[model samples]
Target: MFVESVVRWGAWSILLQFGLGVSAGFCPPRCACRPDTMEVNCSGKHLTSVPESLPSDMKRLDLSQNKLKTLGRRQFLGLTQLQEMDLSDNVISMIEVEAFQGLQNLRILCIKNNRLKIIPVGVFSGLFSLQFLDLSENEILVFLDYTFRDMGNLQLLEAGENDLVFISQRAFTGLQNLQELNLDRSNLTSIPTEALSQLQSLTRLRLLRLTISSLPNNVFRRLHRLRSLLISHWPSLDTLASNSLIGLNLTSLVISRSNLSAVPYSALRHLVYLRYLDLSYNPITSIQGNLLGDLLRLQELHLVGGNLLRIEPGAFRGLTYFRVLNVSSNQLTTLEEGAFHSVGNLQVLRLDGNPLACDCRLLWVVRRRFRLNFDGRQPTCLSPDMVREREFQGFSEKELPRVFICRPSRIIDRRRQEANIEEGTNILFSCKADGDPAPTITWISSQKTLLSPTGRIRVLSDGTLEVRYAQVQDSGMYQCTAGNAAGNDTLSVSLQVKGFPRNRTMPFFTEQGWIESSFPPTANSSAQVANPYPFDAKTLIIATTMGFLSFLSSVAICFVFMFFWSQSKGQIKHTATIDFVPRASMGGGGEGGDTGRFTMKLI
Candidate 1:
């Protein structure tokens, strides 16, 4: 009996040791034992669904890229100790209500890229400790009110890239602990301000690709804690009011592809601690002089593809700590002499895709910069005919040949040189003449009066004269006489006053003492003749006598012919009979009759 008792006690001790080993995850491969640790890595097993009968003590379960279609009731009932689960890239279609009933300790759940169409009420009923939930890239078309009511501890939510068109106002009522939310690339036109006002703990939000035209100025007033924002591809947003981002702690902001025309300096005044600003892919033309004055702590600024034409002289006068400045892909033609004077600590400068004009002024600046040459050749000059075709690589300040030779002064009339001018207006006389000591313009009026009024006619350093507005009194012969150390030349112009005709009722010559009978006198007339036009007295008398003589001569020739014909009618008839009969009888008789008639006529 003693030996039998000893053997039984040894067997009982061995059984107790085996039980403890299995509970600590030292069990054999074929055993169905629970492990003490929370990690359950079931990767690369080609499993279609969450393995059944998992340890109740597991805190994390990763069933990624699987073929899990649905999660019915009691599917996760055994995982009461689970805290996080990753089911991304899976075939999850439907999740039954209360499917996670036993997972009261779950905190993080990621079921992104699934086929979830609807999230029924109480789907997460028992996950009271859920904190982070990501359902992004799903086909979720509908979600019930209070769908996440049981998840009071939810801290972060991501529902972007889904077909959700409407969100109930109270859908997130119980998620008071939520902080970060992403609804990017969703079909949201406008977000109810109240819906987002309830998220007191939300400190960050991303709403990329939401075709929102404009946001109410007070849209972000309730989000006092929001610090980071990203808004892209909103083509209709052109202007942002100054108070649009009021009452928010925005630190980092990105707004791209917005087709903006100009940056409102007031829009960024409230962002005191902003560090990163991106204004790329906009149609911005110029930056205001005081644009970056208030952004003292700005670190990175991107102005790519913004169609910038000119940067004002003091544009960035106050941004002393700007570390990275990107002004690439712009239409910048000229950079003012001291454009970037105040940017002392600017570390990186990107001037690529900018058609820089490498003139004498800009040549030295580009040569001193570290990376000005984007390609092998230096930027080409777009100014001054001499160095226009020259590149920056082969040219240097010392090598740039002698001073521009001033051509001899050539006078040009201001009236004729100007292509188009109004009819009645008087133009200021001026000429551009290149000479050794520069040119001096003097105006000489038609009455030989010199216009020497210092204030009225002032000359600029470049020799452009701004003649004060001229009047009809000022219209007369004006000359622009330019002289230098060399010889001088004068350009003359006659300025005529333009007005309507004097008399509208009578002929213009009548008012000038012209009359119809007032004719020029000949040598015989005693009255003196001043002018003669169309007809003078002597010419008129000569023309009348010649016309009368021609008429009398024509009448006399016709009268003589008629008188002779009347007086010789019978003789004419006898001669005609003799001439006709004799001619028919004999040729000699016809000849003798013809000769007698000829002799009578001659006599």
Candidate 2:
């Protein structure tokens, strides 16, 4: 019995010793260890380097916020099963080429917020399965060629907030599976589009806080698979060329806080598949026709902080699928008709913080009540003094036109404003007037006829009369008449064609005191005219005829006024008069009290 009891005690002692040895090997010094899960938390331990005595089977090791200055080779040796490792916020300034040689199965590696100056080539060559690599908040200056060639399976790369000034074309050559790349706050004026072609599989890319003045042509070339792109906070970005985004298949594009004075329609038209577009915080002034027409798939548009002044008709032509549009914090005064006609699917409209001139033109918004979201700050009217301080939704359409009467400017009826141009050159004559209905302009010739757009005469959309290849016959007074429901305004412009003396041979006179010549002088004709007056009798006759027409116009105006007065509802029916003289004092009887008579009028 004594021999059997002693054998049992020896067996129990051997088991206890083996268990203690395994526990000691699993737990590292100055760290928190979970032996069951094989996770070591050595963060903020102020260690000089990675623990050399880490468990070989550990899956997660965190050495963050440490004083490790350099990572030497074989640092993680034997840790082949390390699937996630974090050395963030460490002062690791240098990493040896083979420092992570043994981490074959590592899937996530974060070295952010370090002082890493350089990562030697082939340092990460064996991390074939590393799907997430975060090297942000470091001092990496250059990305040498083939720096990440072996990381073909990397899906997300965060290299932002670094001092990266140069990156080779082959730096990301093998990262074919990369999905997201963040290069925010990097010291790069322009991206190497050729190098970016290697990221054919990239889905999202961010480039914020750059100093690039202009986006070069084909800036996003070959990035057909890119889905989301953000290029914001570039205060110096002024010009975006037409082809800047020629080859992008982006779904969301944000270019806010840039100095864009106008919408890059040519560049934006290429983004046919874009769903969300944010152009906020720009200085754009106007939105014209076909500018946002082709963005049929767009669902939201952000135009806030742009200080936009006008939106022409058909600006939102093809945005049938648009749902949200924000135009707040702008300097808009009024919107034209049919501005939002094509946006049938719009659900939310933001128009706050604008000095909106709510006139009859904008009454359609109130009548329709198209989901205007002012966020409690309503837009006020700037016209029709009775409703000047009224909010957009405060009044009804019945009360709008009463005070929205507009008066045409007096300067519109002035005589011809002379403009001189060389023969065979182009000239544009513009006429503008302000009225409640926004007057439509038309051009009339001297022959009491309306002038239509012909081969050389073109009328622009903004009421500019353009005469291409000006000839001698084109030299005459063009009557530009603007008319609306309120009133009509007329202005005559005379175009003098110079440097074409050959057209002065046969001059035709008009009743409006303007000349139109059609014949060109022959080469044998004398250079100077023999007439002493330089003014012909025909010109005098035309001037006298214009004066007679003016006299007739005055007589007709007087007759019309007298006729209207006769038909007036108010009229004087009877009249009475009274005359009084000064009376004498009551105590003293003056010579004689003067008689008085009173007169009154009644309608």
Candidate 3:
């Protein structure tokens, strides 16, 4: 009975061991002894290769930061149920063709910070369901064509911080569903026009290392759906062409650095929807009149780091909706009297870092806009001569001097002339003057007509008058009258209306080589007017001679007066001294008197 019992027990034990071996294939290599609910964790185990016989029901696999050199075929072939896979921070040099052939359900694939030089063709061809692919911080130099052709469902593609110099056309052809593509800090010099042409669905592109100078025209023409574009570290750009961004729908554009000079009007013409623009780090000298008039939707404008020298009167006329304006780090010498007149909605105005010149015109504007000063900030004088020994640091608006003065311009010259009217000839009549007030101008024609109001003549505010499309009947003496509040002046330039070819020939005289007989002889006459004021030279000679004679007469008179006065005083003193000397001896007194008389004569 005992031997039969022992035999049955030994057979039952053998059956139990066989059943355990069959169930081991269904579980991971490390979880064979644990309960069924225990997780199959194989992370950070100095793993150099994908472990064999992983549980088919495993939900998570963390193979991050492993010294993995390469991934071969059938590595993750059995992980059909796997959802997340982390292969980041590894030495993954290469990926075999079918390495992820069976990971159809994988959602997150993190292979960042690896030694990948080039993504082998079709390496990710089977990952059709992958939503996130992070290949950033790798050694990838060039993206091979069709490398991401099958990843149509990818949402985020991070390929930044790589050795990529150029992006080949159609490299992202199949990634139309991608939403965000980060290529910042890639050291890219130029992006191919067709590189992002296929990514129509991309809404955000961060090109952080894209300097303003390397930005090419029409580079963003196809990115009509882009909303936020970051182009930082671009310092050398000066002008932006109007059509450079023809079709982009950008909302926020940031371009910083200190080398930019001018903010071209055309640069932001098409950015009609732009709400925020940062043009900091430029040396913009002037803002052209009506330049920002069309940017009605601009909310925040940052002109920091630009050494701006002037702001024209109408420069900010159209920016009525601007809220925040920062104009720091500039050389703004003057803010014109009406520089900020039309900007009613401006809230925060930052005028720091500028060597502002505090003068009458500037002070007037500041005083008018005192409410715009947020923190009692003041403008400083940049002129060394204006501020004595102490530098012109900023002062509060209340502390600023109430009165300031300006010097007037000096007078140059005045002249008048007349000419006969000539027919069938275009005549140009002008009266030029130079002054600070930009003289008020008027014109009158021979027909007693006010020529300025006529459409035939166009008068510029700067005192330039243009007579357009003149006819023969328009020939007559034209008078140009200009004046300021201080003084008034008039000049008449005669326009001869005589028939042409009749007086075309000139007469030759003995003294004058050629003379126009039909034209009257004015100050510009060919002979006598050659040297105006003929008596000027003779008058100068006569004045010089008279001055020399007068000087000699004055010196002679002074010498005669001094000689007579000295002789009278000496004779009087000598008589007094002889009288004071008493007669000591008769004979001695006689000798002394003779000597004294001789001495007095000599004196």
Candidate 4:
């Protein structure tokens, strides 16, 4: 009985050792396996293929940053327990269908930083439970139709930094639960309104480094649930249509580093619930009055680095709950008191990195320095030699007058000016003002818009308004306000541009009354008029057809002429000869009536 018991115990111990050995054998080479957590990591292993013999019960696997060239079919078929997998930062160019067939539980998958040019349909067919997908930093040219139809639960997708030029309409058909999507750094000239509208639950959409020039009206109307819109690096973006955001209920709107020269008052009127507004890093020179009158709920406004030179009175007329205002890193020398008359509840105000001239124009701000928040960086003076770099907070109420001293501005040539000229005429209006601290000049158009440096109408450095090729639309009263720290002055000039008949050639008349010809003779004396257009296929075809027709006509005329001449040669010939007697014999018959006999012969 003792011998039998020893043999049975030995057999049980051997079986236990074999089970332990089998568990260790399942872990692939150069991989770290945690049996307790059921996870495997073979990342950065220079792996050319998915490691084999991985634990089937592994819930998470990372194979990122390797030399993987392709993900073959059934690469992770047996890893049914994998809830998260990362194959990012590899040279993976091709992913066969069913690569993750059995990974039904995969909630997060990353295939970022690869050479994937196209995400073929069915490549992600079985990932029904995928929630987060990262396709960023790839060479994807276009998102094919139904590429992600199975990923209905996808919440976030990062497809930025790709070479995408177009997206199929049905590419995101089944991704109805996608919320946040990023397509930054793409070459799409316009928004993919159709494909993106499929994500009914999308809230935040980001598009950067695009080439879109203008936002059309109601372009985002289909995005009912969109809340946040961020656009940046759009160099060609300039105009924002009045109704561009008509149907958008966006709470936050950010547009920066663009070519927006003016505030989009018409578009912003629809965003009543918008809280944060950022137009930083644009070329906007002035903030027109009543621009943000409708955005009553707006709390924060940032125009940092907007090159703002002027903020007209009533610029922020309707914002009662305004909290923070950042206009730092700009060219603003002085801000008028009326500019912030409506924003009485203003809390944080940033005016640093600006040339704030200490004068009467800015006295109201200095008096309220204690109440206003400068965001830890106070406004400093750039003029008045004594306080060139001094902060406004440094001076007290009693010392304010002695430190920030300046004379009020007055329009020396203030007068009711008028000019009448035909269209296509160059005109100039000069505005002269006098003050202790020279005031800046800003021209306001008849449409209540600030005129910046444009190719046609430009404001010279000496406050001269130069309007080239003036049109009828240029007619109106132009208000030019010159302002400094002390105060400001205004001068209004009425410009009436008469429109000539369209068919009539518009004259090129200068401000000096010189009549320049509209069609100036070319300097080059070449007989051929310079063709500004390139040779296209149509032009080539026309030229060839004309030449062929000319050749045929010439050949036809030559043939007809030859046939007539040959036929005439076969006709009978007739010759007639008439001979007269000697003139002396004829004269002998009668001196007055000398008649000679005529004879005709036919042969």
What is the Cα-based TM-score of model 2?
Answer: 0.68
Pairs of colliding residues, candidate 2: 576-599, 576-600, 577-598, 577-599, 578-597, 578-598, 578-599
lDDT of each: 0.67, 0.79, 0.67, 0.85
- Candidate 3 weakest lDDT stretch, 10 residues: 30-39
Residue-level lDDT of model 3, residues 1-603, one tens digit each, is 999999999885764443222222444343222224323445555678877777665556667766889999757887787777888888999998778888888888889899998887789867888899999989998887888988889999999889887788878889978888888667567765688878888788877665436455787767878877766665555556667777887788776663566786676788888888887776677777777876777788888777677677777776667777788668775555465535556677777567654455455545545556533454445543555222223344455564232223322344555445433334455566654333457777778677654355555554445554344556667767776433557767655444444324333233544344453443433433245666688899999999999999999999999999888876444232233444567545444442232233424
* Clash number for candidate 1: 0
| Candidate 3 local Cα displacement, residue 437, angstroms | 16
Give the residue spans of candidate 4 off by over 4 A: 1-25, 341-343, 409-433, 436-603
Q: How much is the lDDT of residue 404 in candidate 2?
A: 44
> What TM-score, computed on C-alpha atoms, does each candidate reach?
0.59, 0.68, 0.58, 0.69
After superposition, candidate 2 runs with Cα above 4 Å error = 1-25, 34-38, 368-434, 437-472, 475-477, 483-603
Question: Rank order by TM-score, top first?
Answer: 4, 2, 1, 3
Give the TM-score comparing model 4 with the true structure, all chains together. 0.69
| Best candidate (score: lDDT) | 4
Clash counts for the predictions, in order: 0, 7, 10, 1
**Candidate 1 to truth, TM:** 0.59
Greater-TM-score candidate between 3 and 4: 4
Total colliding residue pairs, candidate 2: 7
Ordered from best to worst lDDT, the candidate numbers read 4, 2, 1, 3
